[model samples]
Target: MNQDNRYVICMKWGSKYPAEYVNRLYNMVKRHLTLDFQMVCLTDDTTGINPDIKCYPIPELNLPANLPERGWKKLTTFKPELYDLKGTALFLDIDIVIVDNIDCFFTYNAKHEDSVVIIRDWKKPWRMVGNSSVYRFKIGQNTYPKLLTYFEQNFEKIRQEVRHEQAFLSNYLREHHHLEYWDSSWCVSFKYHCLQKIPLAYFIPPKKPSGAKIIVFHGEINPPDAITGGGGKWYRHVLPSEWIKAAWQ
Candidate 1:
């Protein structure tokens, strides 16, 4: 591995998000990151993805047939041999919008190279859960057999304890590694930080978050919804946000 190689990887296994999300992410990273890096996407379908971005098949988690899928596929990113990718990998969810310089994500903890860095969950701060929407870790490092083997053996027990993949991942890394977080302001949630309160939501268009490098659309309201003002719910009305149109592209 080249000492200078940095990687930004995103997952797009299902049809819930289109290829445009991957392309736009590449463009956003190209604009913001000063460092040289390879843009990679792991997807089930790569028909329309930009040729500049490398495409790899999403590794199989191989869960039981009766098991429910709650973002379990994302765990495969920790595969021991991830298509020859090594060194630091920053994983971004496809729906997230980059609005500022993101070079800090790779450089935040310069001394602690072994630490697993992630975004602190916006909703569950007290429990210290990490939202996997944005996280940086060394490829094929701590989590391969340590995280995967445990999950495979104790999937039943793990499922009973945590609802989703992020919770499972956060809990494991916290126990084993130096689980760090990006600055709270750098990875803001669009719905939490930008959307106005109920009645006011109708009057005001969604506001662009200040000091946010990546605006995360966690549960609802993705980039398209923000661009066209489709907040995806009846009560939450988002008037066409022009900044989203400009920024998401």
Candidate 2:
């Protein structure tokens, strides 16, 4: 693979995630990959990040500044003028762990001609597409303007229709045929792949998948809170301490 053609991309904003998470992800990628690749973080702050990472500012979206903080920020991935990136870029959430080599994610593509490739949620079988937790795309293609346009025209409709960006992407891509669901083994759900909770100590922790390349912390459970098992009242109190230790170390 050409060194210049690959990228590991992530985003961060607000106090929820620390800058070190981005740095740690860079370390994980470097430790696991044999090929030369750039690890880029599109963030609002650069302090505390490793020098190896190319930090870029999070692009402004069409949404209002006063809007409540939700997962909609992820939709910026589709903005053409914002990112202005190129080549095969793998988008990973800051809350995941890289257990196996993720170099293959860039190589895989849809059978048809499409710019975006993602994974289908196994639980929601009827849905044509899945969450965008881990996805690959060619920058500047502007393959996702329809999503932005939809939000622009039907903001209230969307607010009532779906709760997050993933839901919008799933529906929009399903209509356009630009969506491709990846193999289940490539990305596994944390709840399904690891333990939810321990009977005693409330601290037995979760287990990592045998050969899973990426374990995504979707929904309410994230890395920091997952480690402490202290997200909120509705969240499950499962800590994947062993998995986190093995993958990050």
Candidate 3:
């Protein structure tokens, strides 16, 4: 693939996340990537975003208007016709910190003809990949249709069996030989990499991994609230303030 044909993608909507988060990601990608690439934010609101970051309107999947809120809206990334970018693209959640160069993620080899490269969830059983906090894929491949079919055929079954898109994706790719595990150290779990409050909140942050490229904020805690440690909600309370501050700078 032409190295110039790469992109960094993220999705945004509603007020839960601020628009600056999207702009910050754009800055992170610009600082870390050495190749000719574009940073694309798929969003419903484009106001106040950095002008350099290209914005694509989020595509509407034809799911029922009253579909229960299962956080499955994120599955929209898998829509082929919706994303027309060529070659390989890396998708990052806006809540993450790009502490190191991400150019390598673009270069890692795929495991199979239809494989997607993602970090294996070490905390979960080896058979199950944890979350799609960060993943890379080729555009216009229609990966979403296969995913939708699984939900359609096993709608009730999946609702009872899985809580998130990652679980469904891991199962689908496992069956198709299209799931490749990224090197463990390349992507570190925030709970493990930062502070773990088992005994107390006194755990000092460890030295950043020598070659790790990304730090994912998967659940609850995120970069903004993590860096401040001031958000009152229970979900935002476990953040490692010092760690995120240093990582973003």
Candidate 4:
């Protein structure tokens, strides 16, 4: 592995998100990330993806038919020989929008190469839950073999015991004392950290929290909805955000 190689990885399978999201993400990453790196997208369809971004077929999980797909699909990235990629990898969810410079995500705690660094789940501060929207790990390291093996060997048991991929990953890293969190200000949730308090949310559009590098659209509020002002549920209301559009671009 080249000592300078850095990778930003994302996965897309089902048709929930379009290829434009991946293309936009590649552009955003290119704009914000100062390092010399490659953007890898694991997807079933690459028809409209930007040619600059490397696209690969989703790794095989070999999950049982009865198991639900939801978050479990992300585990495919843990394949020991993942797309022949090695070195540092930062995984970003398709819905996240990059804001400020993301150089810190790669440089911070560079010495701690063995720990799996992930954003802390905003809602579950007390529990050892990690929001996998953005996480950093070395390819073929730690969980690749350890947690992957655990899931494979205990396929039936995991199907019953774990609720989702993040849950299993969080607990596995917690047990191994390998779970590390990025600074709270680096990666924040759009709903929890940026949205205005309840009633104010209706009149006020979301703003980027100070020092936040990435805004994760967890649960609801996709980038398209935020741009078009269409992501409103009965309880939560989101006003159109031009700033979000600029950042997402």
Which candidate tops lDDT?
1
Residue-by-residue lDDT tens digits, candidate 1, 1-249: 754578999999768888999999999999999998999999999989999999999887756775665888888877767878877899999899988999999888644665778899888798999898999888854434567777877988888899999899988877876678888999988888888878898889888777889999977788888888875587677777788889888
Determine which window of 10 residues in candidate 4 has minimal summed lDDT: 140-149
Worst 10 residues of 3 by lDDT: 230-239
Error of 1 at 218 (Å): 1.9
Tens digits of per-residue lDDT, candidate 3, 143-194, equal 5457666565676677688877788778877786478877888887665665
Candidate 3 stretches with Cα past 4 Å from truth are 1-4, 66-68, 142-145, 149-154, 196-200, 203-207, 230-243
Q: Write the per-residue lDDT of candidate 4 for residues 108-207, one digit (tens) a residue.
A: 7844556778888788688778888898887854345667777777878866776778878888777764789999999988878777877898888888
Could you tell me which residue pairs clash in candidate 3? none
- C-alpha RMSD by candidate, in order: 1.6, 3.1, 3.1, 1.7
TM-score of each candidate structure, all chains considered together: 0.94, 0.85, 0.85, 0.93
Pick by TM-score: 3 or 4, better one: 4
Worst 10 residues of 1 by lDDT: 140-149
Candidate 4: misplaced stretches above 4 Å? 141-143
The local distance difference test score of model 1 is 0.84
Highest TM-score model number: 1
Q: What is the C-alpha local distance difference test score of each model?
A: 0.84, 0.73, 0.72, 0.82
